[model samples]
Structures are given as structure tokens and as C-alpha cells.
Target: MTIRVVAKNYVKPEKVQDFLGLCKSLVEVSLKDEGCIDYGLYQELENSGVLTFLEEWKDEKSLDQHLNSSHFKEIFPLLSEYLEKETEVNVYRKTL
Candidate 1:
């Protein structure tokens, strides 16, 4: 079954633009991964420095692979520095 993930990143104020730049590359690379159905990146306009990702993957395995993928590893350290708080990720599956 497809898994849905909502990942939130609250970036530090001064690093907002830098974070966006980092995300652009991360998004570009993530989209090319196997079993990645959808990967959408967006910034919360009203709340600066807040970014969110809505993703859909083929399965838990696909999602797990993505978590460990090189793209993730490459960007995580850079992304971490800009975060104001721990990144929050919510995972789900449709029951309907």
C-alpha cells in the first residue's frame, strides 16, 4: 500500500533562503528516486522559514530506502543546521 508522509521543517530565520536553496536540490534528486510517487515541497508564506513536504511512496520499504538514500544523507547535515526545531514527520496509510 502507498504510504503518505508529511514532513515539516522549521528553519532558522536567517537561513530561510539557504534552506530553500538546499531543498531545491534535495527535491530534484528525491523526485528521481525509485518508487517515489510524489514529492512536493512548499514554504509557508505566512510563517517564514517553515517548509513542508508532502510525499507518497509505493510502500514502507520504498520510504525506508528513501530515508537512507544518498540524497537524504547529502542534504540532512546541511538541512539540520538551518532547523529551528527537530524536523517533524508524520507517516500514514489510507484505511478507507
Candidate 2:
């Protein structure tokens, strides 16, 4: 089944641009990975500090591989420091 993942980030005001830049790089690398069906970043219209990622992968194994990927590991620390609040990630399997 296709897996969908959503990650919501509440970035510090001072680190917004830096966070976005990092996200851009992350997205670039993610798109190049095997079984990465889709990946994108979005900012809330009313709240610029809130960033969200919408991603789709071929299956659980693909998603697992993505989580273990070098690109993911390399940028995670940088992304973690910018969060004003804890990040939220949710995964779902598409039905129908």
C-alpha cells in the first residue's frame, strides 16, 4: 500500500528562512531517492512559522529506507534545533 506521511514543524521566528532552505535541500534529496513517490513543503498562510511536509512512499519498506537514508540523518540535527515546539509526524496507509 502507498504510505502517506505528514510532518508539521513549528519553527523559531529567527530560523524560518534557514529552516526553509534546509527543507528545500531535504526535498531535493528525498525526490531522488528510490520509491519516493512525492514530497513537498508548505507554509501556513496565516502562520509563516508553521511548516508542513506532505510525502508519499511506495510502501512501509520504502518509508523505512527513507528514514534511514544518509540525507535524512545529515540534516535532522539542523532541523531539530530550529523548532520552537516539538515536531509532529503522522503516517497513514491509503485505502481505496
Candidate 3:
């Protein structure tokens, strides 16, 4: 099944720029990984501090691989520090 993830993160105002840079690098690397069908990072227009990640993978295994990937490890923990709280993530699988 195709896996979809909606991830939301609220970043500190001071770290927004750094977060963006790291996100760019993370996105670039993730796109090249096996089974990465789609991935994007977007900022909310009404709330610039909020970042949402839209991602799709071939299956649960692919998503697991991505979680263990260096790209994920390198940026996410640093980004987490700047977050207002823990990241919010919603995972879904297509039924139709």
C-alpha cells in the first residue's frame, strides 16, 4: 500500500531560516532515496512558523527505511530542538 504522511512542526521564530536550509538539504536527499515517491516541505501562509511535510512512500517498509536514513537523522533532531513542541505526524494508507 502507498503510505502518506502529513507532518506538522512549529518552529521557533529565531530558527526559521536555519530550519528552512536544513529542510532543503533533507528534501534533496530524501527525494533520491529508494521508494520515495513524493516529498515536500511547506510553510503556512497564515502562520509562517508552521511547517508541514507532505510525503508519500511505496509502503511501510520504505517509510521505515526513510526514518532510519541519514538525511532524517541529520536534520530532524536539530529541527526538533527549535520546535515549539514535539512534531505532529499523521500517517495514512490508501484503501481504494
**Among these predicted structures, which one has the highest TM-score?**
2
lDDT of 1 by residue, 9-41 (tens): 998999988888888988888888889999988
The window of 10 residues in a row where model 2 has the poorest summed lDDT is 76-85
Clashing pairs in 2: none
lDDT scores in order = 0.90, 0.92, 0.92
TM-score of 2: 0.94
The superposed Cα distance between candidate 3 and the true structure at residue 66, in angstroms, equals 0.5
lDDT per residue as tens, model 2, 12-90:
9999999998888899999988999999998999999999999999998988998999999898777989999888999
Candidate 2 Cα misplacement greater than 4 A, ranges: none
User: What is the lDDT for 71 in model 3?
Assistant: 80
Q: TM-score for all predictions?
A: 0.92, 0.94, 0.92
lDDT score, candidate 2 = 0.92
